[model samples]
Target: MAEKAKVYFTDFRCPSWRENLPQKLARLMMTAGFGDIEMEGKYVAVKMHFGEPGNLAFLRHNWARVVVDLVKSQGGKPFLTDCNTLYVGGRKNALDHIESAYLNGFNPYATGCHILIGDGLKGTDEVEVPVEGGEYVTAAKIGRAIMDADVFVSLTHFKGHEQAGMGGCLKNIGMGCGSRAGKMEMHSAGKPYVKEKKCVGCHACAKICAHGAPVIENGKCAIDQNKCVGCGRCLGVCPKDAIEAANDEAPDILNKKIAEYTKAVVAGRPCFHVSLVQDISPNCDCHGENDAPIAPDIGMFASFDPVALDQACADAVAAQKPLPGSVLFDKDSGCDCGRDDLLYANHPDTDWKVCVEHGEKIGIGTRQYELVKI
Candidate 1:
């Protein structure tokens, strides 16, 4: 029926250790058509998540150097980039974000490129890019620096997500590229609220909130939804971990929105996606800590179509045996039998397929892919 997209793959087998994993990744990307793009003197955004401070599941800085060196060889002006997080964490502002990246070893000396916090300091600098044929977001508030890039490349850490089920290429490009406001828009249908028990009467939330959404009374703060613009700044500034997102949106809708956001990021640009399906962690890299991997390490995958790349990765993970002591192995062994969908089996509340289906339906990419092992 439809033409299948080509997804290049490579196992983690390094015959002599001289070639190394980074070299293998570079070779895989080239095989997947990375060199086909005209990159001479063009601004290329290498989007990826710099693992949160203590998380060890993110792609190493050495892996990033390989991509950076490749882009430089092609005369592309490449920069490592990612927008601020929506949740309260170590990466809400550019300063803290860079610190976190450096803490996680994403420094220039390590990655062979400078890091650019896409949304600027305070995560307020953004460009509203129109999403063509979008059912959810008409205009996505993307980081100005990301939108300024002539080419977009996603270097994703393919792992499990509590919400998206699996954070693959689509999740990396879509949700990872969104600005603070954009992330807020995709995350929940309503504003955040303060938990009374967790609130310490600290005016920290009130101090950070521009709209005065957090009003303190009797040492307890309440968020006024009418006044709150859902910027998600308070969530990060709260010292007591009192503020939390409503998370009111349906999982399917959230997945579709992620696809729409991804379309916005890569729509008019030359885009390439690379996913390292290793570390097979049971949660997103955004977490401060990572649990043991759910499955054994798969390998690297690269594709022009993120949807195709993600599908190929999903298939690869499905073919693997779950790690005996990991979360998947311990979670209801009954369902694990004959269940190919380990991601869903790990988190039954979320359906990872929704994102890819919406991606295909929205012309992001095709799910049918030819997995070409390099």
Candidate 2:
């Protein structure tokens, strides 16, 4: 297939890309036909995740400032936003979610825009929109903020994922758009029991359990498997890490959910994507604590096609030698300097390819692409 996405990789290592990323991204949008947006005075939602507090590997606000300014220059009102998380963490509610964004330097003062949590105060605020995916029918419960936007642009931090292999355009749009309940669906596909010894109870997990799986018996949350819906929501809400997304079918189900959500986000809106390949962490930034990066800082990529952008970004990452201090370099390195670990040699257990293939099959974009370096 011909290349449908154009991914430009830039990094802090090269001061030019860092200094010029904003301008580059701005022009990229126009060059890629964002300027042709038919509606005037349209609201352009810049979908971005403000990394959970304590996680330092988030996309820089400076980059966002440039993009937002450019959008305004083009007469598009741009706002940076993300939906509340299903887990009972820093971002479970709008208040906590906004606080986390502010803590992460996304305050309105910094980015010249508002940081609106997709779901409102309780995370139950949603606007269901119809889509043609199997798992979903009537509509996806999208954050009202995201559904209200006239157009969508995803600014993603590309990195390794503990569940879906890697987080990229599709993950950003799909999982990111989900309201707390939407998140419930994606995570609920599998259920893992809590180890009795690991359970400090604390009732944290029990509180978020939509089902009465966890009950506080003598000040400890005891999960009743029969009542549990397998939402996996309780697992992440537990501060002690007692609950976990079981290895059952969570991975595949999560991927499918991600694709369906992406389709929902861009159903009618003209959407564009930019995936930063730098600081390729071994796990998603969803972690309260970000581990050391697994891959060295690569570059930035922008594309209208989520699939091609992901494929190009993956190819670029595979082509580089692991950084000396990073986790990937610590593993035995036999792959070519210019070829990434496509088979995930370092991570024999995880496979990032499934999402790309599934996305292609579902028509998210094309895995077949021509890499264009600018």
Candidate 3:
């Protein structure tokens, strides 16, 4: 049997004379061996989701400030970062992504660090990284800025996800660090297609493609599937946003790909993960609107092993009763929920365990963990 990884936890309860939640979180991270990492004058990529516009359940900037301060104390140049979305949204481009992040109060004044959209403007900047021991993807197209970092740290908001089951440390680093093209590859096995009505005969796609995939005629563009390599470059350069990725990958494969992508990002790097199990929304922060929390606020968790950290957080959530007025509670009240897994109860179509199991299989970290309360 593999030795269990240690995951540190702390509750939200704070006495008037005692330290607050943020302070407690800092202590928890320290206890989890965050200070032991060699971070003297290194560029640390603090990967996290800047909630989509109108999503109120996303993590607040105050929590980020605590992380920023900790990184600074260790002489690490930390920056908050997330890649642009593959779908059309407020964060589809670098300019819009920064705007949305600022709109959500992740400004430098609040978080005490600069915000760098992982992918450059238009979500095209990327570095092809080879995923060792990967069965789904061999090379993952990760954001150039994220790949340039000397250290990687994930600050995740643990929540229910419609596709990947649960949004935890792996979700934050893997999917969040991928460039737009990377996201396309993970979400779809098919190549991108052009909306003839939306295409303005820009020929921009043709110009960007090394392969002659974009065929143009009659003021319209279409991807030639035979020639298309699915690099997803055309999707970024099209001025009219006419091209769209086919998000047809199954949930199980998507989860496995997420694990592989995470392996590519964290391999041969000093990494630490922190997840706050509060505002357990039933959907991702990528959603413009958030539903009520599925479970009550649990606490914060920190560990060197992201897989173990996620497993610990998920187990913590599984132990909680569903929050009243939430979708999970509604399902439980209606009939037998069958399982104690709150994430699955919230989104029955998804199984959060797949990602962690794959992560362990890929040598990222073990799912077995010893949760130490702080």
Give Cα distance to truth, residue 265, candidate 3, Å: 0.9
> To one decimal, what is the Cα RMSD in angstroms of model 1 from the true structure?
2.2
TM-score of 2: 0.82
Question: Which lDDT tens digits does candidate 1 get at residues 253-279?
Answer: 999999999999999779999999999
Better of 1 and 3 by lDDT: 3
- What TM-scores do the predictions have? 0.92, 0.82, 0.96
How high is the CA lDDT of each candidate model?
0.89, 0.73, 0.91
Off by over 4 Å in 1: 196-221, 233-243, 332-339
Q: What is the C-alpha local distance difference test score of candidate 1?
A: 0.89
**Clash count of each predicted structure:** 1, 14, 0
- lDDT (Cα, tens digit) per residue for candidate 2, span 313-372: 877766566666666667656363233473264454656677787777767788876565
Candidate 2 ranges beyond 4 A from true positions: 1-19, 135-139, 190-248, 333-343
State in Å the error of residue 153, model 1: 0.5
